[model samples]
Target: MSIVDGNPNVDTTVFYNASNENNLLYPDKFHQWQTRNNFKSYRQIGRFSDNEIAEHLPVDKDKTVVLIGGPDKMGSHWIKALKQMGIERSQIYYEKFSW
Candidate 1:
């Protein structure tokens, strides 16, 4: 998963990938970029904390935002924050999956 802060002046991209044990792994190069760019990254087990939710919210409050992901509780937290920020529920889109 990745999140961009949406700052044209400060380009930042955080990447987290789940490994075999459901642990997140970050590439060395990515880590280097994060350190150099002062970007924040995380390795989450299942759910994300409110701080993490706050970090992902766009810095540009005027810009429209979209959250896309498979059905999961993590998305709910993001939806809550967006709603609290006055974004319409219709603006959020969840990708569908068929079991």
Candidate 2:
């Protein structure tokens, strides 16, 4: 597994692996980012075939919405839709060479 700090100012961490495991694991100090940032409320929309990713998305609308996957064409499609929905690219983190 590899860990990455998505942004310099943010303490949140993202984990990825070739086995198709990708996720943002919040540090204890950044737990507030999960709550205060409304990460608990956003509904997670994922590809029908990607039940694992969909299951991790926010169940409510107040949480930070997450779109997970590699940079494959499918993931790119989701990224585009997310952008259309006003989600900043910075908010969408992916692992290096995840595709």
Candidate 3:
């Protein structure tokens, strides 16, 4: 399983289940990327808290996590959470984007 950031600016942690498209902050963009990449499934999670973010991650030992956010608090917290969950540094990828 792979986790990506849906919207880093969101003040609260929001899980994008995809089952409920209306709850996703960037449904169109996320859908486009997912389709273009030809991924069978994807999971998006937006959060500012490390513990909260960690709770939503997959427990698999080999899960890959991709983070798309700034290099600030939001991104750092996610990285921290992933680390706490025992995901190796090599399994993580960070992409910073300017609004």
Candidate 4:
């Protein structure tokens, strides 16, 4: 997930189970992203970059992509960048979020 907050303590553990293999008494839930997912959380203090987006995407550009952006026309920026990167308008699905 992409969180633009500048808070250094914005940890992702809260979104997942804290219990690890050693803590057998409270094993992690199957749905925990930390335990079951493979992703890298980037702590960018400024604007997002194309390399950052491209690195995580599949080489096969044929697949459709989804973007969930925040308020203040946050979705607009990424949409334009994606288009410039050769992504088709029809291939993108976006949802602007306000929180």
Candidate number achieving the greatest lDDT relative to the actual structure: 1
Model 4 alpha-carbon miss at residue 99, Å:
3.1
Clashes of 4: 0
Error of 4 at 3 (Å): 17
Candidate 2: what lDDT? 0.44
1-99 per-residue lDDT for model 4 (tens digits): 333123233322221111243422222232333343443343333455677776655566676455444554667877777787778888765676563
How many residue pairs clash in model 1?
A: 0
| Poorest 10 consecutive residues by lDDT, candidate 4 | 10-19
TM-scores for all candidates: the values are: 0.46, 0.33, 0.46, 0.52
Please provide, for model 1 over 1-99, each residue's C-alpha lDDT reduced to its tens digit, 9 standing for 90 to 100. Answer: 334434424544342424343345445645555654555565545655556656666667555446456456556766786778666788776664322
Model 4: residue 47 alpha-carbon error in angstroms? 3.6
Instruction: Please give the distance, in angstroms, between residue 97's alpha carbon in candidate 3 and its true position after superposition.
Output: 2.5
Candidate achieving higher TM-score, 2 or 4: 4
Encode model 2's per-residue lDDT on 1-99: one tens digit a residue: 112223434333232223222333333534444554322322222334344434544444244545465657656766776565555677775443342
1 or 4: which has the higher lDDT? Answer: 1
Please tell me which model should have the higher TM-score, number 1 or number 4: 4
The clash count of every prediction, one per candidate, is 0, 11, 0, 0
